[model samples]
Target chain A: MWLAKNKDEREFTGGKTDWEAAARIAEQCSGFEPDDEDEQTADEAVSCYNCRYRRWTVKSFSCLLPT
Target chain B: MEIFVGIDDSRQLDGYKAGETASLLTRAIEDKGWGKSKIPSRHRLYPNPVIGYKKHNTARSFSADIDEQYLNPFITYACTMIKSNVASGCNAGLAVVVPERMVNRDDLISYAYRVKEEQVSKEECMQLAQCPGIYLFELSGDGRGVIGALAAAGLRLTGNDGQFRGKLKLGHEEYYVATVKEIIDKTYVQQVKSMDLVRLEDDETVRMGEKVKVVLLDNLYTLMVFPTDLENPKWQTSTTHMLRMF
Candidate 1:
């Protein structure tokens, strides 16, 4: 995740298409609580793509939590 | 009579997920003995950020075969529930369609597609919904939810778009195989098909994950499974990652 223009906000640098990378990043994050089942897009249950604070962007999602 | 209900933006920014509202409301309807309802469908709308929405701009909708006499009370009860259950400071929208009353449905469905591709105003939404037999209610806040609520009803009425809420818990605790006939009988899964676009025969074997779910495709609630190794009786459910494209 890279620092967004907003202070303390981070976005998935790998973008949204790279599913495995997103899941790998989520595997190490403590804030990876899954969102609702319908909102989840990752096949892996514990992926950042499924993270509750990952505000979805048209290209990639920005991590809403402070990093 | 058939009553198709759609609700959108019903959850507060800090409250329940908007995707879950329809299921909760449908359960409330059944609990009141108005009629038996089917599982709700979560229809995805345009995810345009310019619309003041950044995430989860989806609507919840379902259809029910209800008694004609219960119609008035049902709508009244539903409106009351939205006001009470929806998060405070949230914009809640609700739309109900009685097939017999909506003499011309093309206009209704057209609005559903319009929300997906263009910007629609609250005035347009109310005008379209202000027809005979079609009821539109704004529960709270700016009532912008009517935009998504009416759109959802149109999409659901078209019999396409959206994924069914909740994972279909089938097979073993983790994974197992079942015949297509058994899949239909044991679960709400209407039909099973291959990712290659072929509908599997009723007797064909399909291996599925514990968390199986169906999506709306070709106007049918379908479970797209893939062959494990192109062999007979070797198939697995399509992952949520794949199904999300719908």
Candidate 2:
């Protein structure tokens, strides 16, 4: 699930700890690129929390990939 | 004398990583016969938007046992390396701390925790730098990186924060299973423990996943594991998400 903050910005509705949701969403997203090894935080190899385009926000994280 | 070298680099989105720079510094120290360096660790800083970091807000640092006479030369070389490697439109900071010579070690440790939980400024770091045995430098740009660099040294001194920079490769497959003693023999890991901080016995077995990582715990390279099956009490290496707190 995602919340559209603007024309090109969106945030993950699952917040930071929703590993299953983040992984599910990333699996379908074409722009999901794995971040640096040190930055990745998810056990799943492919997850939004591990995506290079995801920018961490105070409450959750936002997708930086152009929508 | 033993010293900790801390570095933080704020670079372009696609520029070189600060961790790589930290690793290079360790190699340089050995190549120049300056000292024997330990593995560099990555310390996480407060992620507030005010910091304006490119991605994750983190700094890298490592400890070294060196000849006291070479201190100045090492510092000068580090400064030059960081200045040249920093990317355009970015800032980099370097800090060299000798704990034994510090005026008050507690003050630096407290400041380090504050940087992790709250907004810290360059002025605060500058004030702390006045203490003996602590040196801070701003290599490029606006020099905000000094905040993280100083904090990184403090965290490293605590010996409880941060994870080592790279993974521990013990096998060629997706997973590797070994006894606690065997794991220690194959890698730099000095201790193996469960999630609850209970140290596993030498004969205890562990299943290491694809990415085996170690954290700086109790001043040693510690590998943490969780039970794969409570009934059988099988241990497995902690995953990336599990080690995020470090």
Candidate 3:
């Protein structure tokens, strides 16, 4: 899983290091493919404020799709 | 929120009364507030579009009903409702676009809704007026396509980024209202200022930032997501799941 800082984060934090921060902490990492393992990771990562799909209204695993 | 609803004379049949309906709606809003800062605002009354008796159903002469001479008066009423609601310090404007099909119908009806406190141009208003059969709800923002996410639900537009505003109910329990704003970008075609329209593009390949605002009406909670890629199925599925998280 790859990650990028939010818009507000970019403005607040000058470095692009937030991407590495999320990527390093990601349980299962991939290069943008939708797989069952990725889906499970996404499900477990649900409700995580630092997850790629944070602030989501749904519990779908698509949130971890290499974003 | 304070809302001033205007009914066209065409809508004002012998048994239908706009004033009484408005009063009831005000009470409902007030009751929802529970004496908090959410209390409803003061409404300004107005009588627009004089009523004229006209035959509605061609089945019989007795099917005649009262109708409006013009639609402007009803639109004016909606504007007044927004003005009063905003002046009273409500969060946003909520207009109800009623249709003839909604009257005396046994089946449930789905009315269209827009929910911004912004101003719409006269040309857009005219276009909408021509289609009186369609209901409308005006929300804040330039009626442009850039705000597609504001009104995202219940919209079925292809290749356009739309702000998904939510839905509203009208009249009885038979109606539901939803809204979406289409993003309109410009395409320069020589001397022609053509609009280059694109649907909500997927960002599956690239790791871009995303911003999402979700309103859970069932729970009355709003979720805002940011910096997520569009094409990421995880993001999409998660966003959908979060809608019902409460």
Best candidate (score: DockQ): 2
lDDT by residue for model 3 over B1-246, one digit each (tens)?
A: 111132211111133222333344444433544221111111111111111111010000000111243234434543455434332111122233233533321111111113121222334533443443333343222222111111121111111111122221122323111111111111110111101211123222211112222222211122223223433421221232332211
User: Per-residue CA lDDT of candidate 3, range A1-67, in tens?
Assistant: 3223342211112122233333443444443222211111122232222343322111111232322
Error of 3 at B120 (Å): 17
lDDT of 1 by residue, B1-246 (tens): 888898886433356555566777678778988888877888767654544434566788888888999989988887887788766667888889887897799998888988876668889988987787789988888888888888888888887677897787775555777889998898877878777778888888887775677887676778889878857667889877667655
Per-residue lDDT over B121-224 for candidate 2, one digit per residue giving the tens place of the 0 to 100 score? 78889999999999999989988888889999999999988898667888776667788999999899999988899999998888878887899999999999
Which stretch of 10 consecutive residues in model 2 chain B shows the poorest summed lDDT? B47-56
| Model 2 docking grade | medium
Evaluated with lDDT, which candidate comes out highest? 2
Q: Please give the TM-score for the first chain of candidate 3.
A: 0.20
Which lDDT value does model 1 have at B108?
Answer: 89
